[model samples]
Each structure stands twice: as structure tokens, then as C-alpha cells.
Target chain A: MTAPVDVSLIVIVVVITALVFDFTNGFHDTANAMATSIATGALRPKVAVLIAGVLNVVGAFLSVEVARTISSGLVDEARISPVVIFAGLIGAIIWNLLTWLLGLPSSSSHALFGGLIGATVVAAGLGAVHFGAVLSKVILPAIVSPVLAGIIALTATYLAYRTTARADSGTVTKGFKAGQIGSASMVALAHGTSDAQKTMGIITLTLITAGVLSPDSGPPFWVILSAGLAIGLGTYLGGWRIIRTLGKRVSEIETPQGFAAEASTTAVILTSSHLGLALSTTQVATGAIFGAGSGRRLAAVRWSVARQMVVAWILTLPAAAAVGAVAAWVASAGTVGIVLVAVVAIALAAGIYAVSRRRPVTADNVNDVGDDAAVAHEPAVPAR
Target chain B: MTIDWASLGLVSVVSLAAGVAVVVLVSFALVGLSARVRPRPGGAEDGAPTLSAGAGTAIAAVCLAAVVAIVGFGLYVIVS
Candidate 1:
């Protein structure tokens, strides 16, 4: 049999793929952080993205802990090769693109985990997964983080409006829109700090697996800059499909509600990041958005859209994991495996782009939610 | 096929990731709290003045610098 493929080339390819995944994550999730503010006229779209892009770059510079978690805590890196991780990232990239095209706010965190898990299990059996870490760090947080943040936001929004009940609606809207800029910016910063690092950790781990870096080494400067730039550029591109869904479909977010949601999101996300807990920014932001809507008197929170998002979140990990595992198995076969994986990735990317063209959601059409009053009265779908 | 460099690398990467996360979280807490507690000129009517384009850019700069240092140091530790 031919000798095992060149390890260095594999490492480099994986690293690049990881960055590509990171870039998609940036655009896919940027809507989670800024949709409400943009919807409420708090920040202009271009300005909002510029602000978010800058914060994401800064945030990437902020933390390595989450990166470490992805690199080491979730899976036994020793059992699997860097090539395995590369295959997993390919799975993640595919899932991310699929969700982005649908404008579904799924969990990128889960996607990554699923990808890693799939590859690892295929490479080294179920023993590769750190179940304890998965339970304590991933599952527990996934279940509670969003709900907890939601309740807090709901209460905060109610009190915010009640306290200022005497103020004119116009006055409150204008004012909160202003406050939203700051809070939204903070969330973006936190997003960058936490999410970018995940990719960095992955790249660093690849380096370690390839014996290019020590096991305990953090991600290098070039990795950090490249990841930061990739994510920042993605954020600038903006995921308008999700923006439409979140900003207009979930609820008709007023300025005050947007402010409250952003503020609550900033607080909860920042706290979780500090605790070194890997939380889904999508979940946290979604919870806060719904909570803000429900808190307002007469403001309708569409459980239908919320239900859809939740469903997507629950399925993200397993679905992506399955994809990753398949990719890993194929990639491990030999030269053909590598070629097959690359062809699949390219084909999948092109497919998603083609599908997205049918009902293109750009900044121009992003705000077209059709009669806010009518949508508010739409029937709710049961939460699954 | 080799020593458990993967395990060591994993641990080191985790610490580096966590350390940076903590710094960002703490910084955000401080900034968020300060914005809340500090007295403001126009109250909530005019929104927040400090969260401008310039402010966002500045925060990003700090974040980038911190990430570079943390990762760089972690790599050094692993290599040595």
C-alpha cells in the first residue's frame, strides 16, 4: 500500500478549510447580534456591519479558552489525526452553508462539535468523545443558556418600558435606538472574542497533530490574524437572510425592545464567555429577542419562527456529525478520499449559492417583512 | 505512532482559549457596568454616546492585540 499521505500538506489544507468555515460562521451569525438594532433603526445597516466587523476582529484577539475547548476538551485529539479534523470542518462548512441559505439560526458551536465528534468516532470509536465535558460544557449550556438569558431579557424589557411608561413612544424609540448601538457593539465584540478563538484552537490543534507545534501551544499570530480577518470580512458581507427572519419574523422589534434585547444579550454572553463556557450566541441572542417582544405589552412574539429556530438548533449537531463522519470515513480511505472530499465540498458550496439566488435576501430586500400588523396576528406554531 | 503531544497540545490550547475568554468577559463586564452606573448627560433619551464607530474600532484593536499575545505565548510554551 502507498505510504500515508504527506502530513504537512494535510495540515495546511485543514487549516485553510477551518478559516473558510470561520468566515461563513461570521456572516451566518452576525444577524444574531445586530438584527434587532438594525430593524429598529438604531444603527444603519452599513454602519452596523462596519461596527460589528471591527468588534469581531477585536473579539478574536480577546480569548483562547474556547479555542482550547474545541481543540482539546471535546475530543481526544491523539486518537484522531489532523486530517480527521479537516474532514470534520468540511462537514461544518456544509451545514453552515445549508442553514445560511435557509436563513435558519442554527448553532455553529454544535455544528463544530458534531463535525469533530463524527470524525473522531469514525477514527477512534465512541471513546474519543469526552462525555463529561460534553454534558457539563455543551449540553447543559445549550439547554439552559438561552432560556435563562430569555427570562432575564423579558423581565428587563418589561421593567424598562414600565419605568419609562410616561415617556412618549417616539421619544423612547429614538432613545433606545441610540442605546442599542452600544449594546449591539458589545455583543459583536464578545462574539469575535469567543467564536474566532474556536477556529484558532482548531488550527493550532491541527498544527499540534502535524507535530509542527507543541501540544500545549496556543494558536500562532498568523492564525489569529487570518481567522480575525476571515470572520471580519464575513461579518461585513452580512447574512441578510437570517437578518430578515430575526428582525421582522420573530417579532416587530421596537427601539426600546431592541435596546433591552441587545443589553441583555451583551450581559449574558459576556458573563458566559468569562466563565469559559462555550455558549451558542444564536441561542442567547434569539432568547433575548423573544423575551424583549413578550415583555412589551401587546407586542406579539411569534412562537412559529421561534419554534423553527429551536428545531434547527436541536438538529444542527447530529445532522452535521453524520455528515462529518461520512466525510471522515471517505477521506481516510486514501488518495481518492482526499479528492472526493474536495469535490464534495466544492459541489456543495456551489449548490448552496445557486439555491440562495432564487429568493435572494440582500440588504435592499431584508426589511420587506410584509405588513407588520398582519404578521403580528399570525397563528403560532407549537414549540416542538 | 508517537508520544502524546496531542494531549499536551490540547490542554495548552484549552488554557489559552479560556484565558482570553475570561479577559474579554471581564473587560465587557467592566465597560457594560460602567456605562450603566456612570452618570450621563442626556440619560436614555439620546441613547449611548460612547458606542460610536470610533469606540467599536478601538475595542476591536484591543481584542486583536490580546489574542495575538495569548496565542503567541501559548505556542512558545508548547514549543519549549
Candidate 2:
């Protein structure tokens, strides 16, 4: 038999590349957790992002059990190639940018999972997929986690207002804003623990497959540092498009609602992370926001906006997978194929950026979108 | 079926727990500090930073550093 591949170089490259994706994940999804607070004027924009960046780093250290899930549970690590992972990252990055440009709060978790699943299926056939892990660990959690968070937030919001019914509006707002600081931080910590590890796991899996590292090995120091730094920097840049959508469109978040929503989200996210569940923080946060709104009143939640976000959520996995599968198919043609995919992805990104310049959405213009604004400024119904 | 728990870095685990404790404690402290500093009608403190944004950022940073260090060490052990 041929000697094992000298995977050291590939490991180094894939680890760094994975970190690049982690960093993008951080910036891309920051809006999912903090947009509502920023939109409500609960936190200054810069201050909000800086805090998220730091917490994301801290959270990354909390657990690696989820990383294990990603490394071993998602696919048969024995059968894949580093090139497949690279192509999948490209697919994910492209989808993330496309959705981000339109200011949609799509699920980054789903995108990553989709990318892995797609690449594995294309590279090694469907037998490589761990359906049990996909279902019990990823898919089921994705569906149930958000709904559970929403229910908890709804109950908490209902109680929060009831207990303070005699208090004046000013008193309630002030109290909850004070409480919000603690709850929000918990969510951030939980987010880092849950999300950053995906990259770590992927990199580790790449190392194992390429024979650069043992099968039982965890992510290396460089992998962890690079992933954390990348995500931290991304978090600092902030994804303002999504921030407006989540912060303003879902609900008019008063202080009490914000407090309850944040508290419930923290509880749900932390519990999931500890259990090694790879649930989407975006879904949990959004569900909590919706529950908080409904707790106040039926009309408090903008159903139209919620519908649009749901549609994006439903499309995230399938769309990213389709892109990844196509990229994998093309890349299978070897070096020329890889070059073509890269070129097309780069061109698509540039084109999206050019179109976005027409109505630029920066931190400055993030909050400018009004309540009636449709998803991507076009009318769309909920996909699910 | 035995697990080598030592290789997992128990210190890192404790560090993570400590970080969470610190966030919770600091949040309570901040709220109290804001209460002492800001004088509003009905004693409501509006200036306190929302826990989700500020605390979230701090926690994320800490976790990132920890993960980097732990994974870095893991790499060293495996590579050597």
C-alpha cells in the first residue's frame, strides 16, 4: 500500500481556512443576537459590537463537546478530502454574503452543517452521512431548540409584566435595561462556545482525514487561536444588515421585553451548548424576540417580518447545500475545476457587493429601515 | 472504554467556569455601580449597559482565547 499522505501542509492550510470561515461566521451572525438591542437604542452600536466580539472569544473556551459532534458525528471522517471541505467553505461564504447583503437573518449553523453534509455526500456518497447524528444532534435540535426558547421567553415576559404591573413605564424600562446586561452577556458567551467550535471540529476532522493528525485529536492551538481571532474580528466588523432586521422588524422591544427575551435565550443556548447540541443561535434569539413581543401583545410582533425571516431560515440549509454540491461537482475535475469555482465565487461576491452599493447598509444605515420594509425590499411569504 | 480525562485540560475547564462566574458577578456589580452613580426619578437606572451586548462580547472574547490556547496545546501534543 502507498504511504500515508503528508497531510501537514494541508492541515495547516485547512485550519487557517476554517478560521477564516469562523471569523466570517462571527461578523455575519452578530446581528442575530444584538440587532434588537441596538435598534431599540438600548445599546450604542459600537459598544454593542465590541462587547459581542469579546464575549464570543470567551465563549469559545467553554466547551469542545460540540466540536466533537461536528468532527465525528456529522460525517464519516474516513472518507472525505480537504478539497471538499475547502469547496464547502466557499459555498457557505458565498451564501452568507448573499443573505447578509439583503439583511436577512439566515442560520449560519445550518449553512455550516449543510456545507459539510453536501461536501461529504458529493465526495463520498450518502453512506458517509451520519443520519442519526444529523437528526438527533443537528436537525432535531434546530427545530426544537428555537421553539423551546420562544415558549420560555413568552412565559417569562408574561410574568415580568404581571409582577410589575403596578410600576410605571419609566420604572419598568429602567429595571429591565439593567437586567438586560447580564442576560445578554450570557447569550454571547453561549454563542462563542457553540459556534466557534464548529470550525475547530472541521479543521480537526480535516487533519484526521489527511493523516496529519490522529482520529482522536482535538483542534490544535493555531486552529483555536486563528478561529477565535477570525470570529472576534468578524464580530467587531458587525453585520448591520441583519441587525436592523432582528432589532427593529421582529418586535418593538421595550426594556422589559428585552430583558425577558435575553434571559430565556441565555438559558436555552447555554443548556444546549453544554449538551453538545449544534443549534442555531439565530433561531433561538429570534424565537425569544418573537415570544417577548407576543407576551406584550399580539400586535407587538410584526408577523410579516417574522414570516420573511422564517423563509430565509428554511432556505438556508438547502440553498447552501445546493451551492456546495455544485461546487464539489465542478471541483472534482481537479485544479482547473477548483480555479473555476473560485473565480465564479469571487465574481458572484463582487457583483453582490456592487449591487449593495446602490443602497448601502452599514452600521450607519442599519437602523434606517422602517417597519413596513419587506425582506430585501421585496415582498415574500414565509417559506415554511 | 476508559477516557484519558487529563489530556482534556482540567485547568481550562475551571478557567471557563471562572469566566462565567466572573461575568455573572460583574454584571451584578455593574448594575449596582450604575445604581449608585445615576440618580433618576423612581431610582430606575437607564444608563446601565444591556447585559446581552456588553457581557456577550466580553464572554465571547474569553471563550475564544481559551479555545485557542486549548486547541493549540492539543496540536502540540499530537504533533510532537
Best prediction by lDDT: 1
Off by over 4 Å in 1: A1-7, A371-384, B1-80
| Highest TM-score against the true fold, candidate | 1
Stretches of candidate 2 exceeding 4 Å from the true structure: A1-13, A371-384, B1-80
- The root-mean-square deviation over C-alpha atoms between each candidate and the true structure, in angstroms, is 9.7, 9.4
Give lDDT tens digits, candidate 1, residues A128-225.
88887787678877887677667666766776666545333444455466667767887798788878888898888888888877888888888898
lDDT score of model 2? 0.69
DockQ of each: 0.04, 0.04
lDDT string for model 2 (A168-287, tens) is: 345446645655665566667677777888888888788788877788888777667667777878887898877877776676677667766776676666655554567788888888
Candidate 2 interface RMSD (Å): 10.1
- The 10-residue segment of model 2 chain A with minimum total lDDT is A375-384
Worst 10 residues of 1 chain A by lDDT: A375-384
